[model samples]
Target: MNIYLVYWNSLNKFCFRGILDESIGEGTHFLIPWVQKPYIFDIKTRPHTFSSISGTKDLQMVNLTLRVLSRPDTAKLPVIVQNLGLEYDEKVLPSIGNEVLKSVVAQFNADQLLTERPQVSALVKETLVRRARDFNILLDDVAITHLSLCWKFVTGGNCQRCLEDAVTRIGSSCRKKEDGRALNSGCYLRHSPHKFYNNSSSNDVAAGNRGHRKMAIILAASSAVLALLLVTATMGFFIRKNVMRKRRERKQFGTLLDTVNKSKLNVPYEILEKATNYFNDDNKLGQGGSGSVYKGVMPDGNTVAVKRLSFNSTQWVDHFFNEVNLISGVHHKNDERRKNTYTSESLRQRFNRDSGMHS
Candidate 1:
């Protein structure tokens, strides 16, 4: 009689008669003796900590750390064991994590990555969870724990020796792309070298394979001048565009203020922020197709709706601007009509009072 005790946190799959094809869960009295093989898996959640070095959109190297809480789905164990063996997470998680890291980090510049860390983490987690699900893995939590610029090494002289050394030292960290190539992907995440050396093409021949003594200085100066020119052009364009946008908004706002003077709803935006607790999640009322609306309590015991539109959404800017125009025009017209009605009522009352006094 062959029998084994199975614990609650563990799952067991057995094979009978040297064949695992659609037959499983052996090592029982019902199975023939010496014909069953057993495999056990622990279904416990575990923390996976990994560090990835990737290049940012601004061409800076970033070292990021991610901690993931994950476990295998017990139902998919058979397929996972067959395809990936027992060490499945080892073969899958790191590769996919590194890939997602590179793809997401490349989209954001270093400053944006730092300023908008939450959004970055959310993006990484959303993509990583989907990838893990494809492998029958369930992720409970994913977060970016630490981040810093990869300042391990600075600028280096352009030479084949430096290139070969970089390839040899941290080469193992590089991952193979989906195309099945073992190229030097690691160098992309590391310090930026003065030159890139590949087998297909050599470094500049006219530069005479020398160190960056003269060539480096001249190149650095030229790059600085070019960067300055580009920055000046970009700043000028943005400043002009911003001025135009503000001018239009102010023009619309002026019309509203002229009609709605001394209106109760004329509260400052800062006051709205205070009333809604700075757009706290708890104050959220409901989300519409266009944006989210929140419940706000004014200092004067007035309840107001605070609408916040998502600027990053694919929605057209014209739609938002048009909505603003409609709101302003409606309020201005209403105020003007009310003022005319009040004037006519006051004149009628004065005419009746004077006639009675004369009598």
Candidate 2:
């Protein structure tokens, strides 16, 4: 027989015949020789402190001190041992903590982390807990005990003096307040029940107030200039659009007038009167129900039949329609070489040429 020691405070089991798994308890136990091997695990709560170097959202490098309280998940002891072996803490905790710290730090700026430590620490704890669960580690708590820039920012002599004054003011003004931090461009002073920062005096708080006021003034001026520029641009755009629209309309109208003029014959009233010999009865050709026709000699020494419509007649609209259709289709041809009768198209072409010369 063989004797084995097992503890109930942790998960203890025995492997029998290399194939059978059985859970055991605390105290001394007897087992057949070469029949079983006892496996004991330590599952105790403990704290781990570590420092990590990472960059914040603002690209400022920061040094962070983190303390984590953790333990092994007793229920998952068999799985942890089987999957990651007994040295899982040594292999996993450091890496998990480093990754979680970096991820959390990247979510906030260095200034924000310093001023709002509680908010930042709470977020880090929540994320670390969830991440630890994946590795079968129980997370009790996570605390960001310290946060600072990795590089020492140089401060001006005046700013340093002001920081000292601000720190003294904060100490006296709100003694009951649990936490306070005096911040400046180059450095900060944080105070609590327990000392957390260097024992250096800080800059003046009035400098910070002046800086905020100047920034506000600049922002207001910039907003006014931007608004003026936007309004000017909007006005210019509409003015240009209206001008271009009017130009397009005028151009279209001119084009339409040119086309209609090219398709029509516009004989001047004076020229018609002269061609018909001032409407002498001798030039009258015939009379129609709507109007009268006369034989006329054009300036080019050609004879044409001009039908003058009577606008006062009640049938003037019907007669005008008939005359338009007749002029569009009427054609005259001369069979002999000396004959030179022109078609209505030729008349319109002649009229355009004559009008162009007069204009």
Candidate 3:
């Protein structure tokens, strides 16, 4: 094996040769064994620097400093040796660095890079790594160490136009205000005041007119403030009313839920099942146009009616819960009387049917 010394200049061109006793040409060269040998490259780190001026979105010039680490990509050595000759650094590395830097920097403005240095650095590193992949090189990192603006053309006289523009704007605003006041007061410019302003009476009339206009402005402002206060009060009233309404609704719903939970109608599913004998036909009391009604007896010997709706009873399905809720809310004081009347009527009909059968 032979030891080689390698050095790549700023242009990315490589200069390398085997150990030889004397200096050789600029390109890569070979050497014989031990009889004549050259010293190998002993340096641990190398630096590559390039300078360029970039343009911002607002057409400002910025000077940039770009420094890159120099190293050989051993994975692509074979291809580099075949196509680019032994001086691969001269042909590949500089080109990659320059293109990646130009492309990435051109996408950002000067202010962005200056304010967001870390982000800009990361962007440069990513771009370089992607471009280096084709040559089998991995970029370790990239950094933007220095940035500055080139302000060689600024002068004091350049601000004269900006000052004149500001004065013109102020004059235009004052003229517009004066013209509006004249129009509001219905003043016809029959005579030019440029000459008549020398008279004392004319000056007094102008001063009085200005005082009247000032008083009108004060009155208008006071009216606007009063109207604003009234609107605010009305809005607050409506908001409070809506809040109170919602609170009442919630309170009522909570009370109704508590009453239902505590009522005797809070029958368990298992008890309902035992009372109805698993919904047997023998337990069914009557069949109506809507559905069959079953008679169920509770564990405490209390009788209750259970109405099971039929599948096709769409009208019953819609009104069943509403009817049950209405019936549940009837005054408990009259409930016993109503129940007695219903039972007596049912018994009378049954007795009449039996008598007719016997006859």
Best by lDDT: 2
User: lDDT per residue, candidate 2, 212-240, as tens digits?
Assistant: 99999999999999999999999999999
Lowest summed lDDT across 10 adjacent residues in model 2 is found at: 334-343
Number of backbone-clashing residue pairs for each candidate, in the order shown: 2, 7, 6
Poorly placed runs, candidate 1 (over 4 Å): 8-32, 150-359
Candidate 1: give the clashing pairs.
14-25, 14-26
lDDT digits (tens) for residues 202-270 of candidate 1: 445534545566788889999999999999999999999989876765464455344335443444555
- Quick one: how many clashes does candidate 3 have? 6
lDDT of candidate 2 at residue 164, scale 0 to 100: 79
TM match of model 3 to true structure? 0.31
Q: Alpha-carbon error at 332 in model 2, in Å?
A: 99
- Give lDDT for model 1: 0.66
The better candidate by TM-score, 2 or 3, is 2
RMSD of each: 36.0, 17.1, 25.4
Q: What order do you get sorting by TM-score, best first?
A: 2, 1, 3
Best-first order by lDDT: 2, 1, 3
Local distance difference test values of all predictions, in order: 0.66, 0.69, 0.54
In candidate 2, how many Å is residue 95 off?
0.7
